[model samples]
Target chain A: MIDYRGLQALAMVIEHGGFERAARHLFITQSAVSQRVKHLEALIGQPVLMRTTPPKATAMGQRLHSHWQQVRLLEAGLGIASTPNQLTVRLTVNADSLATWLPEALVLPDHPNVSFDLLVEDQAVGLRRMRQGEVMACLCASAEPVNGGRVAFLGYLRYRAVASPEFIANYGLKDLSRLPDAPCLVFNRDDPLQHEFLATVVGGTPQRIHYCPSSEGFVEATRVGLGYGMIPELQFRDLLASGELVDVVPGYALSTPLYWHYWQTESDVMLNLRTQVIKIAKQRLLAEA
Target chain B: MIDYRGLQALAMVIEHGGFERAARHLFITQSAVSQRVKHLEALIGQPVLMRTTPPKATAMGQRLHSHWQQVRLLEAGLGIASTPNQLTVRLTVNADSLATWLPEALVLPDHPNVSFDLLVEDQAVGLRRMRQGEVMACLCASAEPVNGGRVAFLGYLRYRAVASPEFIANYGLKDLSRLPDAPCLVFNRDDPLQHEFLATVVGGTPQRIHYCPSSEGFVEATRVGLGYGMIPELQFRDLLASGELVDVVPGYALSTPLYWHYWQTESDVMLNLRTQVIKIAKQRLLAEA
Candidate 1:
């Protein structure tokens, strides 16, 4: 069996790009770094580093390092010595969602016993991590439920084709076809949801777009007439109500289904969470679904 | 604001039974239950119960009950005394991911000040709660990237269309299109990713699907020839390698893009998680744009 400490030392070496630097980072001797890497390679029966000017982690090293990191996080959560009923609940979520509804869900005072650990990520990655056991729950796009879990369909979150009136006045998008060529604001290149919707309408990905990675920035960009992008219905609703945002596509918007999925494994805490979420979805989101 | 005691009383009533039963559950008189309910109703500006036979909760009462449940779960995590580090992290994640990758990200021994509380849930719902601030992080769907944070585009998770040899021989799905309407094992009705992929290839959604809500059951079902479903590449790779399973769609499996998102707010803990996740993603996941 490989010693975890040896593997950890080697990882630090690779991260620092050299044994000498790694020694400084870990407050150990440079020779120790070299020794650990050598020991790890001997145990794995594979070379874990390249003996180059700036040392690089071999494929084996990278894989092991990745695995080691996961072990570390798990240990941290478990390390919390429980005092009586002090159980920690770790959650993964997206930032915008954190800013919006999570606060509403965690109305304290009533829940005196529970404390939280928040892991924020985008919807896509959050699900992947959740599946990996990095987090306990997530709000994700795949309406398809997870196995060993109950599916609480939170319904589709609508996206309005929004733009500031000033922008609309400048570039009158008379039809959906014109959107591809228009200067559009996008969350990022990876955000193909808007493109997917546009493809459904225009038959292909849009050619003209600018990347705004910030959620607030994306909305603000649209408001300032950077271009028309699909803004979440909830955020745009008030803006639309205030006449700040005009729907480029009136009476039509793209919506992606959202689902709340959780493990079916019976834990009083987890069971309660699932039930509460389902109830809330039934009240707030099921109608939309 | 409403008194938490009233909510607690309502919870007891709901959990126990009618006012009389609730009184027994709380070890209080029936009249107290009646009074507490009335007080709660007045506080929320809505009636919570019928006050009649069997005493059903009203619509607003249901909402309150759900809220109370979330509080209970959060309270469970917190225990009694409030900790100085109340910026708790809560997560809902799948077990496989937790088993394989998540722990490595959260528990780096070096980061001592940072702590986590974990809740395991299905990937989909984790995101929903994250959006609601019920959790700070989640593993979810949607590669489009969220704002107020950076998106670390972790590579796509590939799922192979595998089946046990027995299943392939019995169903003869060499050409997936030729297979008769065999019951395709699925996590739940909401899980349409695989179905959507099939729809794209088969030209429509299949009419017959066997739902397996348990992850283990889903995997076992596919292995035992109950049906074929797309299984995660990591878990099923060995099965395919050993020739225990056959790939229905060789070289045609689906790969879902994953991303890591978190608050850009100057939070040491969130930043640590974000950095760790990105590093791991680059190494383990298919690191692409």
Candidate 2:
């Protein structure tokens, strides 16, 4: 059997980006870390790591690293931690979800031993992080799952084209045909929501555009008349009711279906998270088939 | 003199990723786009674009692209547009400022002709986007400017360690030394604020850590007892005042100095942005030398 310590060394080396830093992190000497990796290579009868500046993992190394993570999670799930009940689960999530209903689902019970490491990514390509083994799961727009993973539909996130009253008056937004002449807001170049909305409603692109990437800041920018663009229902519903934001194209809304993708695991923390996310997401997002 | 239309074609090819898309966008034939790029190469006396699958800009090509962008901006400033008045400026900005104060500065005067494209980036590495020629400016934490760029000191963004009352009570967070035993939140793996804050206070790292990348969501996560984390003064000052959040460590705060870095330009839009950002950031941020 391969020593678990060797796998730990391999994981640390990749995580820290170098043997020297891994050694410092592991509280071991640099040569010992190298020897363990060498021993791992010998046992596997193939090179697991590429010997480069700040060395990278080969396919074999990545597989072993993934195996090590799964094992660690299982151990933690079964209360077999050597470090006294400590686990860190890494994942990627979209900004719209993070700004809206995801936090309620995140507020788990008092087993604070299980920690989280989250990176913000666009929902369209979030699953790539999981495929790269950078994270164990991703909350994204696509319902497609990665290899050895499962997917759950999280319902649709509806977006409405909105602008402030002052903005509407100043830009003469009442004429639907001249909508393309007014300034508009987009999250970024990669975000196609504004284009998608325009394609559905006006069939012409806006001449003026402002990109504000923060989900909350997007609302604020629109409120202050930087431009008009699609705002998620979860974020803009209250604002619309309060008359802070008025739909630029009334009676029409764009809906994007969202999905939660996670590697199939027996870990209690992951299972609980999956359950919580599914339950809360169903309750919050627009219910759909 | 080199044909400006050929330079426009070259820029479109690099921007749209291929000749076909560039042709479609330019309302010209695919072969015509190719011929224009070929014409540019002949004028330069060497290859400007690498004939790769997605056609990358060589150093010469990148220089020409930057030159074209500058000339376009100059023309916009001088009102020489073929499509009347239209200008789009792209830049990268950090999230904290976006959530707190940047949007007001973004709401420019009635020229609505001056549009914006902003991408969210961590302050430490945001200048890389500008250096890559993807953006004309970057709002970042570093005072050091990029090559041929100008930087203005925007004062410091102060951060204080904070937690919910329930979290503090549940985790016994009063004792300063036992802080690392409690779960802590960070922006992401690349963020060093928690480590730096801990080093200053306890000199021990937290075994339980949560990383939430959104500046707004980070606060929400902390408020909902996901874990204690450092919150920016601009975001949390009201929460602190209203008793929604309490200081984990009183009488001490970490302050990150912010700077505005912009490519040296005579374009009115960029200059106005620089002026407005500096004026507001100085007012919002802590006065620091």
Candidate 3:
């Protein structure tokens, strides 16, 4: 049988990236931490850590870590005498979602004991974190549920290709074909929304593309006429309404369907967090499937 | 001979993610974009792109795109009658470098035609972008030169494990072993410097860890006593001196050596940019390396 203490020590090492730090986190002596890890490795008959600088978990180690994390969450949900006050809800999310409706969802009642540890990445890649057990939940663009997780439709995040009035005028961009030569803003190389919209109107990449990774920074870059880009309808509503930004192609936009995936747990904290996210998303995002 | 125009068209399709957008970027009709890509594929006797909702580059296509990007940079550097006014310098950098000395390097004299497209990632992973031709230059932890790029030693970024005065007093964390129960802050999962230091002092990870991804946010969280964290010497010098924060293990710290890697090019812009970076890094960062 696996010793729970040894398992916990191993998980902490992977999470903290060093045995010494893991010992500090476990409130134990360095030798104790080392012995626990050695015991676990001896039990398994193989090495768990790479033992490189800032150690990495082997595949077996990753699986073990994932298992321990899930078990901990399950125990915490059952109120099984764990450190309840120190429960952390680790999750991955996209920047746009965090900027728009996520803050409201985070403040929802009934999750007083849960603190957040958010990992922000592009929605396209966010699910990988959940799959790898790096996060317990994820807000992603994928509609497919994780192996044992429940997926909920969270509506579409509408994006309009927009630019400042001065940018359009300065570049004389009357149609989409001119976009290739004009300065354009992109979230990152992985972000495909701008290209998806451009596919409908023109059909190519912009020669002069400005990459602004921050959600607010992207809007600011667009506002300052640094480049034209696809801006979220919810976040850029004020700027669009006040004539600070203009749609490059009127009535044309891309609507990315988003989904929330969470582990199927009996925990009230998980349920409450999921419900709050759905509620906020429905209220703020486009209702289209 | 390979058709340069068709290659350009194919590269745009990969960048923009579809033929329609590629056409728009190329200032051509959708049919023309389709024809160009088809012609290239027919000549190569294989499909280059996976025609999905958001098109993706095939292995062959990725190679072609990388080659095209490099060629474009070389052409631009030679001042070979391209869009001279729209020169964009793409690079990847670590957050601490971005927070500390990078901004000053960006404003160096004699580089008026250049604009920036910066990708913020961990220094350990930043070099991969340069290797993949995703960026022309990178600030990375690796001292080895990329295939044809020059590597310059940029000195060490020293970090001290620090916390707010109240937190140290409240937790009575005289040594590292007590860190497990106390709150601790991490930059992210990939950041192992804190754990590395802890391994020397305690030998385990903290159980109650908070991840703050932003450079400023991490410092703010540490200052507010949400948790203790490893902070860069250059960034937290003022706070350390002001008594708002205290070193958890005084006189003990980690110094990570950094390096700048860039494509070996005779292009005046590339040369000027490299020189300016080295100059600024030497001035602000530790000069020992």
Candidate 4:
């Protein structure tokens, strides 16, 4: 059996990103922390931590982290109250959901003892993080599950093409010919949504664009007349209802289908989170078309 | 002499992430787009794009993009009415500044023709993006100039350790003994400020942490009792003043010194931006000690 002491030392080292800091956390000497990890490596005949500036976990080290995380989850499931409600659920979620309805799921009492380690990533990028063995669950665009993980269709996170009233007036965006000259907003360089949406409706991309990486800031930028792009349903629903946001295409909305990918475990925390997130997603997002 | 058509085709393909979409924007066939990029590669004796699934710019491609961007900026600076007031200024900024005083810079009338391409990255990583030939000016923490790029001190972006009322009450965080049990919040995996701040103030990291990457969402998560985190001055100043956020460590604030690194150019647009941003930074951020 793997030593819990060494596993913990490895966990602290990787999580905190160094041995000295991990030593402080584990209430052990820096050399002791190193020795514990080294001993584990000797036993396994594989290096766990790479000796980078801030030491990084190797693939073996990542698996070890994943294993330790699962052990913690199982401990929580079995009511092993050694630490009295101190279990961090590491989850990676897309920014849009966090800005919208995921907060409801977080506050729900199903996992009262559990806190969270919410890593906000874009959907296209989040799956690799899961594969890296860092997170317990990922709210991702990928329908395929991670190594032995399970995936459930949450629903299509509906987005509508929107711009502020001033933006529309400034560019005369009602005319498709003028659309090429108008400043557009995209989340980042990787976001194909704006260009793809434009390609479908207007036959091209905007000649000029502003890439605002923040979800809330995207809305604020749009409101203040920086540019226009796809805004999520709940985020724009109130704005569109109050006429704060005008439709770019007038009748077009895009729905990005999402999936909840989680570890295939009977651990109560994982199961509870899986159920709660799916339930909230169903309520918040549009039904899959 | 290099061809503008081929350069534009390369830019469109990289920006939009595909050849087909790029062709749609350029009003050329997909084959024409591919051929233009190929011809440029043949001229340079190096591949511009990696031809990956979503084709990525190689090092040569990125430098070409950078040269193209500087040319665009220079064109605007020269009042060359070639594109009729259309230039996108690509910049990577730390999110806190964006949340606070950077928007003021955006609205200012320094570069009337320039739109923005703002990529939000943490200070630790923004430097690499600037080096990757993605951005012309980078608002970063790096004091070092990038490949003869001009660097100026923009003063310190101050952050204070803060938590909502209920979190302090729940964790009894006033006592340093109870601090380890407190659930803290950090921006993301690469963010060391929270733990580093805690280590200095209380001599250890919090046992648990939540990673909220969004500048706006960080404040919202803290407000909604997700977890306590270090918040920026303009973001948490009102909350702390109103007693909505309580200081985790009273009388202590962490100031992160920031620098603006811009492309070395005599272009009026570049010069104007440097002046405006520096002026705004001095007004908004804390003076370096």
For residue A149, give model 2's deviation from the true position in Å.
3.0
Docking class of 4: acceptable
DockQ of each: 0.01, 0.64, 0.15, 0.44
Off by over 4 Å in 3: A80-85, A107-115, A121-124, A128-134, A202-208, A237-244, B1-71, B81-89, B94-117, B127-135, B139-208, B212-289
lDDT of 2 at B274: 83
Which is better, 1 or 3, measured by TM-score?
3
Give the top-scoring candidate (lDDT): 2
Stretches of candidate 2 exceeding 4 Å from the true structure:
A1-3, A16-21, A34-63, A81-85, A131-134, B1-3, B13-21, B38-63, B81-85, B131-134
Q: Considering DockQ, where higher is better, how would the candidates rank from best to worst?
A: 2, 4, 3, 1
> Which is the better candidate, 1 or 3, if ranked by lDDT?
3
Candidate 4, Cα interface RMSD: 2.2
How would you order the candidates by TM-score, starting with the best? 2, 4, 3, 1
Per-residue accuracy of model 4 over A1-289 as CA lDDT, tens digit each: 9978889889888777799988987788999999999899998799999999689889988888878887888988777558463566788888888767776576534555676777777765678878776788898778888887889998888788888888788778878777767777788776778878888887876777777877877887777677788988787777888888888887787888888888776588888877888887888788864
Top TM-score model: 2
Locate the minimum summed-lDDT window of 10 residues in model 2 chain B. B79-88
What lDDT score belongs to each candidate, Candidate 1 first?
0.59, 0.81, 0.76, 0.79
The digit string of per-residue lDDT tens for model 4 on B72-149 reads 878776665666635667888887887677765665344546777787876656787777767888887878887868
